[model samples]
Target: MSINKFIKASIQEEDQEPSAPSPQAESFSDFDRAYHSMLCAGCSCLCDDISYYMKEGHVTRTLNLCEVGWKRLCAVSAEDRVPPPSPSLLSDTVNQAARLLQAHPPVLVLGADNADEAAIRTSFELAGTFRGISLPWAYPGIRRFYERAKRFGWATGLLDEVRDRAESVIFWRADPLVTHHRHLSRYSLFARGRLTERGNLDRNLAAVASHETVIEPLCQQFFQLSTDQDSALIEALAHPGGGGGLDHRDLPALARALQGSSYVALFVDPEKVTYEALDAMFRWSAKLNTEGRKRMVILPLWDAGPNIEGFCRVSLEKNATPWGGPFAKASAGTQPEDTSWEDLAGTVGSVILISSGVDASPGNVLPKGLSEKPRVVIDPFKRTPALKDQVVIPTALPGLESDGIFFRADGLPFDVHGIEVWRNHGYPTVRDVLADLMSEGR
Candidate 1:
């Protein structure tokens, strides 16, 4: 089959059962709220101020959740095919997985950015035991910013701090209007901070993107610049008086506003940005701190799978850097080589994929041979595995079915409480499966 057709079929199969639209709040006056305060796991923000109404053990309506998140919460009643585990069969499966790990000298363990810390760490232990390479599934788009912050400590804090203290918020190559639906209303423009009680009236909002977004109306200044011109804009900001452009007479004024702000926060999105552009942003933030005596905090608008932050945190502690496969070290006897995604197929003998309720398909980056390898997939949903001869183990959803700790985009740990209603359902968590695998090896 063609790749396009396969992708289309996979998507169609994934969304086999569309959820029913939820009613308005006015229609639910008499319905008692069961899960009144809930945490949303849809986006990386992990918005915790959710009001969920339950009818007969299933979530019916959610208040204060964004449209995307509301739909995820409403999917609790979908015909999710989760089977009860049979001990004999599960043991046989785990033994088969363990044997695969033992046989494949340097297996590449991937995915689990959306899993809890426990699961992420357990997978690491499993890999370490077998001397295999473990890597994050999602690439860290804000790695440059993260590295800069760690190397040269930046004056930064959590989302609440940004909402309360920042006087000027600049979106550099970022469109929170799409990635984070409630970013403007909940944290920046419409949110009345402690000092800026007048909300957007008391703050300056600036954006630099290729095209306009829904949040353009709230922007104090919008610079419609091409991707190739990001460095030029940064250069102009660095030297505002140079007037390096023939168009947009307001560039100097915007630069002045950024320089003059008492407290400024820069929200960067690197989805379309290059490394040079990242370097310019780092330099821009550094210059702002050095020259003005006021520090500018750079926040990213990128969201990863649930526990990518946790994986990064652990990776930083152990490896002094956070990255996805294929990572390699200096020598064979030394740590494994810090590998890139492009180098995986040429190196590894086998692959162990963890689906984590998201995309389970092998990405196009994998070589055809590795892509065709018989593998193991751990996921909550019961969709067909991308590989033909793959072992599919059903697990429980993190926030809805299982309780664990997950970090927000800014690295703040949020506690997730699993529904007690799902405890008796006999579904396993990523941690459970990994732990059992590790235990089997011992």
Candidate 2:
């Protein structure tokens, strides 16, 4: 079937009214079956309650998947999927990639944000083997927040806990309506939990953003400020007695919401605010917990990628730093610090990118000179037009075409099981390609 038809069928299934019967109501033909408890890697939520029906190797119906998740599943039949290369061509390409690394002397591995845990580890191992550095794409503020949380302490809990017990929710610089479509309905604002029986009605909702967001209407209090005012607003909220010389209209209402609620969950998107503001917010949350008068937790909102959390976890385990680095022994014990593409662009000779579900071209997302360097890209989709010097290896899409362990944004791990339909593609996984490259180098 064509990609358009596949997408249309999936959307029609998703648009079925809430009153419709279960998908199981349909007859099960020999080629038709249902799979449940599948995880969606479209975002960091890693929503695991997804169920779908496959007819003759195509997804005909689905349940509990948002648009993001639906598109991800439809990506299996996406037209941009890289065509499988012949065995001899693949071997030659792997050899070429190995030669590039050997000649470059210090490869910069990128794009682990969308890979599985095993693939992330292998990327690190590949970097170590080549005397290179493995850097995954992530928000700078998130790395800063991790460092601060380590030193000052992080008063955070699982999303499930927030759903069950949180009495107040403050979306500070977080726009879940756009970034994480199911986050509010499944975990935070609208979810009906044991204690939050009435969902949004039972909790006080507030939002603090530089501009208007879709979530503002649902919030009892909305604080709209300019980008420059974030630090001052956080400062004022941190120490209400001081006032911080910030004349904000919604300050009093925001303060009242926090003061009245016993349990507060403050969700902040680090990308939208400066590090100073994030640090101040963290300190303020820590202070609230220290006072023992109320329970306040800071939950960061950002989509570095679905498994960026896995990258951080693996980096911490292997390199002793959340940011992937320490290529030399001298920096082995160095403290964790934020590393951006700009930091590594001039230092490395070549790059090895392992990405999945990324639609942007390298020239658009990568640093200036880095895109011009010799590179090897392992991805399920064709990212860029062919270049004689560059090597592009096709791979199976993790969580849809391959099974692996992926971490949600909350740092919880879930096993992603692939359906059997796409196994015939005969494409290697990121882990497989990395393993081949490592072997070829030896």
Candidate 3:
């Protein structure tokens, strides 16, 4: 069958499903209700094709949204996802984020994976310029993989690109349906890409699942692994030669399955795959390339707040180091004398927290480097109160209340627009705050 006919048939299948027209919003004049691009960062699908139906003021109906997106758009409240943070509590945090690092810039800047990448880069350049630390964020693992990417090459392409170019997709410890609902529909499977032409040709998709999942049902091939079996697979993949300096035969099925592709796409969840496991997975991808696959691409899955991709790029520039760079290292930013948050709070003079999506309480902490001093926070929300000298300056929510370029897990650009559904004591961006702090010289 022709590629065009195959694509048409796919469309026909979608057309058969019940559908509704998007609400006509030609009359609403409210700024918040105005037409804006709706891209939910709640998950990795990073679905960019969202539109909203405005009622009195806020979104009454978010068109084409999935469950996660629907939950975010809807006012369904949860303890962890909806606790209103107080600036006062955060205001009471240690001032080390500013003061200690002010004397000698920090080297390692971790946690860029949690926030928007553009802002993170601002933080990175600040670190690098100040000679602050940047490396291995959140944990000690994954640095080698990052270093490898930096050395061999780190190529970034978007989900849209995958839909357009990918012929074979291999999901390693990744379930886009769970992690990113509608990904298969909007971007991967049901998506209409330019190359989807050759009919169901050799366009293969495979997934590794804990149980029969939404992914397993849809993939052309499935690898079911118990926790133990999964670990064994990782071990086998990592060693290739199976620990005893010989290739193990247990992975023959996986090896043979992988053999049947020209171009392949590999996706893995960073949280699930350890460094060694990830190394093995990459080795397999590399092997596929040498074995005559036309192309090879890898997509790393990361879980964080939002816009982690933009922050990574920004952090890399500011710190001369990537996000997850070392925060304890002197080269990243050294504050050896700075007291820990536990020791400095209440006793130390005051505090400041330049943060977003953080708990605003005494226990709600900053890094050891930032918690020792008294300071102020440049925030974008209203949260809990402080224990001592505290001030919470509200800021805007990236992509929601503010406009910027956000990045995906694969480090591709995602243009964002505002979507303010609630009250926020908005403050300036972190970059602006740093500029102000320097200008004031306080």
The predicted structure with the larger TM-score, 1 or 2, is 2
Per-candidate clash tally: 13, 0, 75
Q: Write the per-residue lDDT of candidate 3 for residues 28-50, one digit (tens) a residue.
A: 45324634457766554566767
What are the Cα lDDT values of the candidates?
Answer: 0.67, 0.76, 0.51
- Ten-residue stretch with the least lDDT total in model 3: 331-340
- Residue-level lDDT tens digits of model 2 in 56-102: 78777777887667766666787776677778888998998999888
Best by TM-score: 2
TM-score of each: 0.82, 0.88, 0.64
Best by lDDT: 2
Order of the predicted models by lDDT, top scorer first: 2, 1, 3
Which portions of model 2 miss their true places by more than 4 Å?
1-31, 327-340, 356-358
Runs off by more than 4 Å, candidate 3: 1-37, 41-45, 70-118, 125-142, 150-157, 197-204, 209-257, 318-320, 324-393, 419-427, 430-442
Worst-scoring 10-residue span by lDDT in model 1: 329-338
Model 1 regions more than 4 Å off? 1-33, 138-143, 150-152, 210-218, 224-226, 243-250, 324-326, 329-340, 356-370
